[model samples]
Target chain A: MLTQRQVRLAWLLVLPTLLVVVLVAGYPLAQVFYWSLFRADIAFVEPPEFLGFKNYLYLLQDPDFRQALWNTVKFTVFSVSLETLLGLAIALVIHSNFKGRGLVRTAILIPWAIPTVVSAKMWQWMLHDVYGVINILGVKLGILSQKVAFLARPELVLPAIIAVDVWKTTPFMALLLLAGLQLIPEELYEAASIDGATRWQQFWTITLPLLTPALVVALIFRTLDALRVFDVIFVMSGVNPATRTLAVYNRQTLIDFQDLGYGSAISVAILVLIFLFVVAYMRTLGREALR
Target chain B: MRTWLRLGNRLLFYLLVVFVVVYSVFPFYWAVISSFKPSDALFASDPNFLPLPFTLDHYKNVFLQANFGRNLLNSVVVAGGATLLSLVLGVLAAYALGRLPFPPRNAVLYLVLAMTMFPQISVLGGLFMLLRQAGLFNTHMGLILSYLLFTLPFTVWVLVGYFKGLPRELEEAAYVDGATPLQTLVRIMLPLTGPGLVTTGLLAFIAAWNEYLFALTFTVGDKVKTVPPAIASFGGATPFEIPWGSIMAASVVVTVPLVVLVLIFQQRIVAGLTAGAVKG
Candidate 1:
């Protein structure tokens, strides 16, 4: 399994990728870690002062960071769960006999393919209070007595954002699950039906078990993406703590507020949280995803 | 009773299908129609659902008036450059990892995948500092370099599976012809990677094009700005005005080509996506 020539060849091939990754990923990661120790406020006319553990200590008590953490968890949990359920339903439906199946699949990719910024902006226009179509449609359809501002209110912001996310990403989840659905043999379903196993029973005992790997992988990907949510929320509500995510709050601190060290600390906190999620998933889910 | 049940099931299935299509396509349709409408019509209490009496003023504003075309060009350059570089590096790494018995091979693969999971925020400050120090703060090259974080890992992860999927007999024949591993890869396996290249390259281009935060953070001037940030920053002449028409037009302009590409390559894209996830 171990050959010197093979190892040399592989390194020769992989050298450039390794080099770029170290520069773009590894070095920046190290720099963030290093800066987490200092108080690097760019707004002041002073050099960064080393203040080990202080930024992190303050971060532990930071109200904004806490709110962001809560918001991220809420967005991640709600959006991922909804996307999974809807994605699963769509996959199952389209997996079986359906007219225009290819057309339906292609139709769904439109939402997923539209740029996130465009999605946010388009929805922003639609969710406008006075002249927006969503409000207009809601009133006309008797879903609402009057127009409602979807993005401005604290109560509705996360839900509005989740709806937008689900719209954009459910197709993606459906595609992944559909791929998993295709992997299971038709014979299994045929034999089960012959054995008098109802479709529901077949789904529970066979489909669900076989789909767990794809489902788990999809969850991990979406969770990581949701955990780092930005553009959509940022575009809809600019730095509003009502919907500020981990990345948003970090951007506010680091870029907007110019608290580089404190921002780096926030960045490290986010890094660790995601790191923990990956590690935990690898531990419990048994790394079927890696295969 | 059985006939009634079958009829109801068909009706429900068709109903679900309609809902899915409308839900997915309606907003995009709305965006297109809105882009064509005049400002006065847009502000009316009851909106026109159709693009009647359409005006091209918004498109005029986006092209003739603003620097959107330049921004689009910047996006094309950056996305194109990053995709080309990523495909080259990814192909190299994938071939080596898929074929060779290398030490730390598995570790490298894990590392490549791990980069995607890294909190991009963790690297933002450092990347900013590095770019500024290198005098590449607002350059397309810098944007392309920084985009390795997103594009490279994806290409490598997807292409690894593509490389692995190739039959071993080809490689053995190349070896029997006294070809070195590199020659076998360059001459034989490389030629067969046409489809894999197209899929990964298109996906990478799309990823680079859609990126916002990094572009927003890195570039400060209009010359190097891309569509997402450029569109985000579009506004009316006054603080009270939002220029909804212009924003919608810009959105439509940048979105149509991508939507077409995705529709055309939907099958390959699905293959690429599942390979990234399920095949590792």
Candidate 2:
């Protein structure tokens, strides 16, 4: 614990990795922060002017940015809640002793394994106005009077993107919860059973309490990821700045519009939000997951 | 009365299982079957569940003309290179953190794990500026380095668990036998954590292989493009006329490797997926 030589050796070993991380991650992070305060043009920059807080102030007044904030929050809350419930239900069902449980567990992972772009495209085709299977089934089953343009209608677009997200991510949630479920000692359940406890009572007393850590971890991960949603919305709704979340909008500002200062400010805001989530997660995870 | 209740429970469980499977697997099956049918038949009023008059024209076009193969190759090179590099670097970092007692060791670990949660959006602006300046923009090298943002953290986290699970005495014994630290690591510790190595490597590969956002933003030319963006907007060239058959064929081709891996190592896949959640 106290040898200088040992410490030196350890540092030497870690030096290369640290260098790579700094070069790859640290440098870019610093550059972005630097760029966010200047009038950096993509095409022509004779001498970039320093414009501190101007970009952020402009963004605050921007209607599109405000709408994006609201959309991100709405998407995260709805998607995370639904994914958790569905994940828990699926986990519980599979946790019980059943035939072909192995097969079922593997089947569940198919959605999570498929690349997000493929799944988003699949749903896009299914939600197409005229010939989508979803509309076909909806009309046949009398769910809708006529074909609905799921991606076209502004009202339905967000929900449609959320649906694709939920479809793709619920399996991931269920897999994590299933691992948590598997950890609870069978002895505790058996002991409760011998005490004449009903299944519902046993689950309340034993299962849910022990599952809190995993549930919180899953929720935090999913919610944080969802809040920065981009691909599904970008692919399905065509990144019109109306359906943009923080991520999609940030892309528009930097790449499409080349507003580096404004984009960096948005990025800074997102970084702060993520930092808050990590701290909250660390508190709930109680130092174990950190290990 | 107890037997009757048990019977009902069994029936309900089976029904639920059936429902989950159908809900999960139907779309994949739909994509596969639809890839074979012609476009006119796809929009038919009374649709047949199976592909009637099956054809290989879709696969033919996807391979012959769509340049999907080039995209697939680029993804393989980028994903494969990133995974390999991260595995080597991450393993070293993980080993040092796990074995060596250094100042701020715990702090470093926490920082790396926390970085895993940093949404890509937050860093995109900064990363773009830096990369463009460094001449890394619109290059495969840039994509690989950017992917390390997720892969390195993920690899280190998974390997921490693996390194912890390994017995210290084995490596201690090797060191006592006069082997150098590097020798002990390469010859002794690594071989023992074979399964962990495979699982971590596989997860890293999959994440990089499927990544869409960075690849989409960074790589403009087909020479450096990856599969996700290519497949995502396959119809953009001719917006009105979707090459549905070719798109489905490409999806199938891209998906087959992952599907096969799942079938072969289903248990390991499940274990790997939830590596962070459950532990002994």
TM-score of chain B, per candidate?
0.97, 0.94
A19-84, model 1: which lDDT tens digit per residue?
999888888888788889998874445798999899999999989999999999999999999999
Candidate 2 — which residues are off by over 4 angstroms?
A1-6, A44-46, A281-291, B1-5, B277-280
Q: Report the C-alpha lDDT of model 2 over B63-157, residue by residue, as the tens digit.
A: 88888999999999999999998999888888888776679898888777766776877677667766778899878898899899888888888
Work out the TM-score per prediction.
0.97, 0.95
lDDT tens readout by residue for model 1, B1-280 = 9999999989988999999889999999999999999999998888988987599999999998889999999999999999999999999999998888877888998898888777777788889877887888999999999998989998998888888889999999988888888899899998898899999999999989999999999999887999999999897899889999999999999999999999889889998888777754
Clashing pairs in 2: A32-B126
Question: In model 1, where do residues sit more than 4 Å from their true spots?
Answer: A1-6, A42-44, A287-291
lDDT of 2 by residue, A187-269 (tens): 99999999999999998999998888788778877987898888888887767655778889888888888777778888887
| Model 1: docking quality category | high
